[model samples]
Target chain A: MNFSDIEILFVEDSMDDATLTIRALKKGGLANKLHHVKDGAEALDFLYCKGVYTGRSINDHLKVILLDLKMPKVSGMEVLEKVKSDPLFKSIPVVILTSSKEDPDIKRCYELGANSYIVKPVDSDNFFQAIKDLSFYWMISNQPPHHL
Target chain B: MKRILENFIPFLFVMLSAFLIAVFFLVLSNIKTLDETKNLVEETYTIINLNEDVLIDVISIESSIRGFLLVDSDSFLKPYENSIKNIESKLLLLKMVTEDRDTDGKADELQRLIILRIADTKNSIINHKQNNLTIEQKIKITLEGKKLSDKIKNVIQEINSRQLALLAQRKHDNIDSDTNLKLIVGVLILVILFLILVGFAILKIQQQKNKLTDELKKSNNLFSTLFEHNPACISLVRISDHKIIKVNNSFVDLLGYSSADEIIGKSENDLNLIVETSDVEAIAKLIQENQIVKNYEMQVRTKNGTLIWTSASIIMMEVENIPCVVSVSMDINAIKKSEEKLLAVNRELEAFSYSVSHDLRAPLRAIGGYATILIEDYKDVIDADGNGFLKSMLQSSKTMGNLIDDLLAFSRLGRSEMVVSEIDMNSLVKTVVFEQLKNDAEKIDIQILNLPSAIGQPTLIKQVWVNLISNAVKYSQHKPNQKIEISSFQKNGQTVYFIKDNGVGFDMQYYNKLFGVFQRLHSKEEFEGTGIGLAIVQKVISRHNGTVWAESKINEGSTFYFSLPKIKIKTK
Candidate 1:
């Protein structure tokens, strides 16, 4: 597979949440040319094309990055900070998709230049619908910066 | 010192009066002595005059007797008789004037001489008239008369000399008394002047004392007014005895006593005022260390035996040279009760949010996800009945999810801090209405009228507008026109924003359940809702210190009204 064709970067820790999100995206016809990372460190590795992702092309750009707050190592806020601080990745849209809407980190994410915030619904149908809508809005409808 | 001065003043005055009275008596005695001297001098002069008259009468009798013996005539006899009569009377007057024993002796000898002279003259005259007297007999009578006259002269001289001596002594006494009186009067004048000076000094001292007393009274009045009218309970307690020396009206009222008299002069322990004696001991220890006890909360027992909460600030103060603890306390029972209630509500809310977030959502997600997987992955094996049941189960879980989200949002509305700003209601309502209508297929004729600006938390107020406008659109969807009007006006200093909807309105009798959480006026078949939207709307509007109400008639229309404070722009 060519890494330059990848357009969606999904970062999440829970296998169950990731499977459901990928399933929803696939159903919504947005799963093609996507990349998945288990934690913030792996997400960083994938973004900078470092460590296990060194074989990937550095010139490849992701259309959108979906971040989760709670994780096992190197939390999502640190990942957002690292990506948003770098000039190369700062223009890329960041969408926070998490289970908790009550987490105060939602405001911090927005303050750190997050493009959108969405709370995962407890019901599978609503959750799928929310992911489908987010994918359509961020990847299909929103206009990306020319540099990205 | 002042009391001693007050006592001495009257004593000094009394002594001064006594001295004045003594001087008056001395002046009166001196005057009496002068008067006695004057009377004695007058008596001496009269005695001398009487003595001289007696001498003249004796000389006249002697001269007339000799003339009668030589001329042997009646005229000489007449002079002799007249002389004898006048000499006797003059001798009596002399005796009366010389009433004193020393002068009376002289007067008696003078009288005997006059009588002898008169007898001798009568014998000579008889001898000459009878022609039986020889010249030698007449001459012998004349010699006897001369002897008597000489003796009278000696006695008269003696009486005059004694009167002269008496007059001289009296004159000396008068001079002495006059000098003594002058000295006494001079001393009296000096004493009177001294007394006047002392009286003036006493008056000045009395004026100063009166001024000081008035000043003391004014300060006492001020202190009493401040103490009695103070809003907080105040009391002064003596450190040594723990006796309540003074208590304000507020203190008496706080203790449920009739007056300050009921609390004053009684120790806190004696009156059973403090619920815990240990608290008093703690405060006393603090004051003894010269440390102030600030906001020391404790229980205090009222006169009616009810215990209430109090927050007291106590410090040691010097009052009238004695160290005392001045305590100022507030009756904080109401505040404490409200604080406890708030704490309990917060705990309940915490537990509620926890359950909503963790326990409720986890099971709900499992139910919905597992149902969806069963239907999707096991589609060929499952029958129509199983599929329908799974679909219903999925639908129910989705509804439950929405319900949970709404509940969480409602609860979060209370916990979230408000970010207040000036909100343009016109644009805010337009945005919410536009966003809400973006996904809906049905046409909503939203007439957003001229809406004024307001002061509120923008995000919360936006939620309120979203809820109201969406409710209007959902409830009024059945109408053919589906007309909804949004407008605002200033009412009684508040900006009232309203959404008027022509919908299948509910009965007015159920208005009480309109804004309650989870309260539904219509069944799910009629309208799909978690019934938490209006409750959230009410919560948000109320958090802004505004009101939410609805005016509706069944099938006629409904108007939802919410009022917020108008923003005031401060001008410099």
Candidate 2:
């Protein structure tokens, strides 16, 4: 679990949803160098190098963070707020992957500097395809900052 | 009050001047009468003095004549002639003074006697001068002369007495006139004093009346200014006829009229001011019941025929003893339009949230992702019961996904814009029933009855028919005969379409929950449904300004009725 090697951070509270998302990413051949956290608090801890992540390098930034809106403890909105406010990790791209395309949530995510917002589709085939395309776009098509 | 005084003051002045004029004429007449009396007294005194002078002249003539007889000389005759000449002139003066009819006869008799006496004396003197008569003859002539003198003295006495009587009468008349003048002058002074007092009182009353009038004018001006310049639209209408009695500037401007005269005598109906006559009736009823209507909303058609909404506050008032309704209206058209827009936006937002929740089925179904992976990865290791449990989990998740989709569709029906057109209900129902029963294995019998055409969005109405017909077919699938009937008829100017199914119906007491979103009367095992079909049907029909209702009895068939207004067809 070297923090420096982690390029994609997935923050989701539902283990099943996380498994599906990771499987989709793995199917797209983008699961290597990916890290998954149970909720927003673990995501923040890992990003800021706190608690169990204290021995990790603080300068290590993920290429992109897939943030879910609703979670236990610290919500994705709070995580985005902390990460976007900090000059050290503000350049890291955040993609809001949530079960809703609600206007207010999407609007607020963008206002908090979310790079992308996508609503999860109800159909399993569409959901899998959406996740695969998003992973490919962020990991392969899009260029990451040199610090990542 | 001041106006009354203003009229009274001039009248009072005129009356006082007339009184003064009357008094002035009375005093002038009295002074003229006194002057006439004074002149008459002076004339009477002159007449008496002239009478005395004539008597003295006669006496002197007699003495001169006697002296001429005694001396028989020319000097005595000279004195006699002088005396005679003086006597003649004195006699003429007396005659002139006594020319009035009452004294003229007396003065003439005195003149005759004096002439006879002078003549007798002259004859005697002539006899003495000739020395032709005895002394007895002279004595007799003298006696005759004396006798004539006595007659003359009597005549003079009578004329003097007449003059004295006239003087007494004139003095009495003068005293009477003086008393009358004093009485008239006293009465005139009292009358003028009374008139002056009355004039002063009138002046005071006039001043008070003028003051009141000034105050009234000031208040009236203030009221008119407020009425004419107030920012809110205000009108006074006669209560009996609803006639506009007066309208302020704002009211005129609000109605897009140039002058109040255009609207003053017109009734609300005459001007077509109220868009809904029913609202007018309602307001009238309220006013009759309460004598006041406050914050009543209505649409007003302006002068240009543009309808605008307003909130009015009206109260009954008395104007010039006539009952009138004074109404103040505020332009609420902008607020009303914005409010409706806001409600529409809110509905859209609600629909968006439902659509967003529809997206939650993705993660919800993903919750079975682990089971899916288990069945795929450990197909041989898992027992049959374990595999069955995982499959049920997946099935439940899929069922939930279907429910979310149905819920989203229901919410979207609320937010979607409707494109209204003429729809052929007969073909629409037939197509829906055919599609719903295409793959059915049950011996279902659906009788499509005669259906009337309707005006609505074809797509939405088709969806409503599809839901209702499919529900009928699905519910009656357990029946051995499986009879479903679709029919439509006209009811209350609306085309009512109903779907009848011989299925396991619900109790009438739970009818309220039949169309509720996610409400289910049967368990999932008994009837496989998301419980959103009736809710969607209700929403779609309601969007067309129609209604949906159902009549059912437990263990009996159900009839779902939905109605759409039957618009009158126009003939070209």
Candidate 3:
């Protein structure tokens, strides 16, 4: 599969959550340039153009990254830390999409330079609307920095 | 050394008094001896003078008689008469003077011989005057007179020599006594000087000792006052035996003992006071390392067998040269109870929030999402009843989700740390009011008075305003002319803000359930709410060290009020 021209790197561990998010993005017509990774490790690999994503151009910067907090191997915090710390990718907007609506987690994500934090609502419609609105905001309404 | 110093002054006083008394007696005896020697010397001189006078008179008589006999004139006879009168008086004086020294009747013999000589001289004189005496007879008489004269001279010499000897011995005694008196006085002066020096030193030492004793007494009183009367329970335990050597009133009271005697002289183990022996060991270890241990929390059993929590500070010290631990314990049972209670509550809230946010929400989301997907994808294939069931399932999940969210918010209100500052209530209420009404602000008759500033966490206070304003707006929505009044008043040093709305207010019978979580007086069909709004308001207000209450009359109006402290609470 072609990895270039990817605007959104969606990282999530739960397949059900990932499917619903992708469906919401698809419904919004924002799924074409988006690439989904299962965990933080895979997301980092894709970002650094390593592992299965080797040979992907480094200059193809992501416009936004939707990161989940709780994951299997490498957590979303680690991914967010690495991406935000790297000067090359720090400019990319990272939105935290998690089911945990804890205050400390939200504060920590923001403190770690997250652009936005959204709780995956228990109600399907609200969650669907949240995803739809977030994707639309990042894709169209928000003006991305040059090189991001 | 201190003991010796304590006894030294009195001992020195007694010794000095004894020495002075002895010196007084010595001087008195010496004076008496000198007086006796003086009298003896005077008596010896008087006796010697009397003896010499007698001898001189005898010699004169002898010479006068011889002159008279040799001249044989009337002038010679007159001289002889005067000589005889002088001889009698002189002999009487010699006899009187030599009475004390009449050894072997020497005075008597001398007197008799002097009389005989005088008689012989008279006879010679009579014979010469009458011309009836020869020269041989006169010569005989003169010879006898010479003999008497010689004897008289010998006796006078003997008496004078004896008196002289007595005077010389008395003089020797006087000199000896004078030397003795001088030596005694010199020695006494030296001894007195030495004693004075010793007395001064002893006095100085006594003064210093008195000062030290006074200070010690004062400090001892101060220490006992601070220790015994201190609110903190204090106990001294011997390190070697772990026996409680001392306990204050507070300690006795803390342990529910009858008196300090009940606790003192008993080990903590003996009394079964400390609940955990390990805690004591741990405290001992810390004290050993630091020489003091502070705020070590432990549980102890009282005499009544009631266990209580105490925050103790143990200091390693010496009491009367015995190594001991001075444990000062504060009865922290009340604080500990509240702390434990708070911890338990927080843990439960956390678990509930976690379940709601992570565990409970996930499955709810999946159920709701799958149902929606089924309805979206299999709408035509499924029957209408199945579609209705799916929709109902989605609706139930949504309601449960709202409940979970409200629960999570309520729980998080407790766990969040509050950062307090001055909150501009006038603006804060207006913002919340504007947000709640949005474009529908013109529909309701909302009156906002001049609200006072309050001290609290701004965000939490804002939430309080949001919940109260939203409730007023929601409840007053049915009124034709909905009047919502927002204002604040000062009550008991707190700024109490209330929102009054003319709406279908609930009955006062359910006032107890007003701020209870998930406790609603109205049904879902009546008011679409999870009944968490007032609960959240109450929680937010309480966290700010304030209170919340409401008054309402059914079908008339309701006024929800919450108080905010004018001053911020100092939090640790």
* Best candidate, DockQ: 3
Error of 3 at B452 (Å): 3.7
> Per-residue lDDT of B279-372 in model 2, one digit per residue for the tens?
8789879988998999998989999999988999888889999999899998898999999999998878786665567446646756566667
Candidate lDDT (C-alpha), each:
0.83, 0.80, 0.83
- Provide TM-scores for the models: 0.50, 0.43, 0.53
Residue pair clashes in candidate 2: B1-B209, B2-B209, B2-B210, B5-B206
For candidate 2, what is the TM-score? 0.43
Q: What would the per-residue lDDT of candidate 3 be over residues B186-296, giving only the tens digit for each residue?
A: 988898798788778778887998899999999999998998899999888998998999888988998888888787788988999878879978986897799889999
DockQ score of candidate 3?
0.44
- Model 1 misplaced regions, further than 4 Å: A1-16, A24-67, A70-95, A108-117, A121-148, B1-355, B358-398, B417-505, B537-552, B556-572
Model 2 gets an lDDT of: 0.80
Cα deviation at B92, candidate 3, in Å, is 31
Indicate the DockQ of the complex predicted as candidate 2: 0.21
Clashing pairs for model 1 are none
> Model 3, B482: alpha-carbon shift in Å?
1.7
Chain A TM-scores for all candidates read: 0.92, 0.90, 0.92
Docking outcome class, model 1 = acceptable
After superposition, candidate 2 runs with Cα above 4 Å error = A120-123, A140-142, B1-11, B14-363, B371-395, B398-515, B519-572
